[model samples]
Target: MNNLLDSFSNFSYRNKNFIFLSFLILPLLWLGIVYLGSLLIFLGHSFFHLDGFTGQIVYEFSFKTLIELFSSPANIDILIRTVALAACVTIGSAIIGFPIAYYMAKFTSPKVKIFLFIAIMLPLWSSYLVRVYSWKLILAKEGIINWFFEKLNLEWLLDTILSTPVIGGPSLSISYIGMFLVFTYIWLPFMILPIQASLERVPNSLINASHDLGANKRQTFYKIILPLALPGIIAGSIFTFSLTLGDYIIPYIIGTSKFFIGQAVYTHQGTAGNIPLAAAFSLVPIVVMVVYIYIAKRMGAFNAL
Candidate 1:
């Protein structure tokens, strides 16, 4: 048995076609088990109808749940809001992360890199729930920001935040600011690493050459570095945007009860006991992610990098 196994291992490695085939097929195996299987299971669940009276799903073929999901005005609103939130978070992460990644790649000393990297990564090692819950504490009345403002005599900022009327009333508690901050904080490192990698790979000689040609800082950034880093920027944005879209915990912990699509799905599956609708609702994030990835592909983001 040992001789046979050793012979096959040698034969497999020696055969280039077999090796290439294995490379191609391994990913399919992964896709088969993960994505395709999950999607089929979801589609199967979509056929199952829920009993409103008993709050259990019945294994019956129906489109009623799907229709109801689409027809509802609240569902539409939630979907739109979730997309808008994701867009804002993506843009915010890009803007903030670019500077940090650029500074780290271009200027930060090697001696300090280890310490700064640890500091940057410390938040990720901590409990996600603990961090998110802290946001609630900070955003709630008598929170740190409010306390700081009060101490600094910046009453106007507080008044502005607390006064902005939304669906019902004051916006501070359910304000979009809290949601954006948490999203940006959680995903900033993802954005930074990619951009930093791209920026570090950028030849210093090119920047010097541009400078020699009398290009200013902003001119060089836009003309040379920005174009190269665009791929990483888009890549980071995709991850941040997609993750924020499906985020159930962060908004639930930090923001108000106003429905996000993720919350809607959570309610349907867990609380409302509408498995089919939840399954249908689950498609929202998947489709949006696919669309964003497609757009990235069209931009030739991979090849350009």
Candidate 2:
């Protein structure tokens, strides 16, 4: 037994690749068999058809579900709405997070940086549902926001926002604007962390060199900082965009009757028992992320990570 153990240790020491593969084999199997296997099975359901009369799923493969997914006006609307919201959330996160990230990276001392990092990450330590529901209350018609507006005589401004077409509803909590706000808030940390990381990697010497060469602050930023940070921004966008695309809970709890892709999937699978339709809805975001990642890759976004 002792000889066998010695021989095994010697073999492991000699073939580091074997040690690496031994450690990796279980995780790779888990990923391949459990994760990818389940995903393939779920996606395969999209090819099958559901019977309307008997409420049974036909095991045979067909394009009927895919056709229905694209052809239906309502489904198309949901898809469009989801895509638009994701885009809006991504843009909003970028806009709001960049300044904070820039300040954290370039201006703050180590102690202040730690404080800011904690502030950014503190919300994530709470339950996701709790955070979302808290937003629901904060944005409600009779919430503190409304009271504050009334106190300041700015109720008209709030009313005007709530009265706007398409994006507006009877209350802020039930409006697209509110949903957008929540999405942006939830994903802002993701955006900030990446941009901050990228910006930290920017050499101070480069900035000094640019100044020495007679480049102004604006010129230096536009030419050097922004270009280098583009990858981080894109990486962050991937998180914010993909997350908004698939989030059902926020839309369901906070927004109007309009369906996003996630809500549609939940309804089709859970309530309606139309598994194929749900699977098809699931594929939309996957396809969208594939395209998005492809574009991000083309722009060298992975370099920042």
Candidate 3:
């Protein structure tokens, strides 16, 4: 036993590559075989068609499922809606999160920074469903929001917003507007942290140099700050965008009866028992994320991540 232990220790001491590979081998195998294998299997389903009359999946591989996915108007609408919502959520997150991130990164004292960090992350420490449900209550017609509007005599403004076409519904809790607000709130931390990280990496010397060169704040921000922060913004967008694309719960709970990609996937897979269609629908986000990542790579967003 001692000899075996000595030999093992000697082998590890002599071969760093072996030690490195020993640490990595299990995880690599798990990723390659388990995670990736499952994904490939799931995606394989997209090529198979369902026998509509018999209601069983026909395992013979073909493009019929994919064709049906794209050819259907309802399916197309769901795809478009999901993509649009993801884009809007990403943009909204960036707009709202950037200033807060900038403040945290550039202006806060260490103590204040810690406090703000805690505040930003606090929601994440709780149950996601709980936070979502809380928002549902908050956005409901009889919720505090409506009550506050009534107290302030801004009920007309509230009514005006709730009456707007496409986005409007009987109440904020059941509208796209509310869903947007919830998505932004849920994903805001993801946006803020990355931007703050990127901003933190920006040297104070650059800003000083810009000012030394007689550049105004506007010029410095536009030229120096914005460019440096672009990578972080893109990184955050990747998170917010991909998350919004895949999330079923938020849209299911908050939004109108109209379907998002995730909801479509869930409904097709379970209730409808249309696994092929569900698998095909699930691939939409994967394709979108692949494209998004490609674009982000061109813009050097991976550096920020």
CA RMSD of each candidate after superposition:
3.6, 1.6, 1.6
Local distance difference test values of all predictions, in order: 0.81, 0.93, 0.94
The sequence of per-residue lDDT tens digits that candidate 1 reaches over residues 162-260 is 566652225445777778788888877777777777788789999999999999999999999999898888878778888888888887876777888
Question: lDDT (0-100) at residue 158 of candidate 2?
Answer: 92
- Name the lDDT value of residue 193 in candidate 2: 89
CA shift of 165, model 2, Å: 0.2
Please report, as a residue range, the 10-residue window in candidate 1 with the lowest summed lDDT.
164-173
Q: Estimate each model's TM-score.
A: 0.83, 0.95, 0.95
lDDT of 3 by residue, 12-60 (tens): 9999999999999999999999999998998899999899899999999
**What's the lDDT for residue 1 in model 2?**
100
- Cα error, residue 76 of model 1, in Å, equals 0.5
Q: What TM-score would you give candidate 1 relative to the actual structure?
A: 0.83
C-alpha lDDT of candidate 1 relative to the true structure = 0.81
User: Cα deviation in Å at residue 30, candidate 3?
Assistant: 3.8
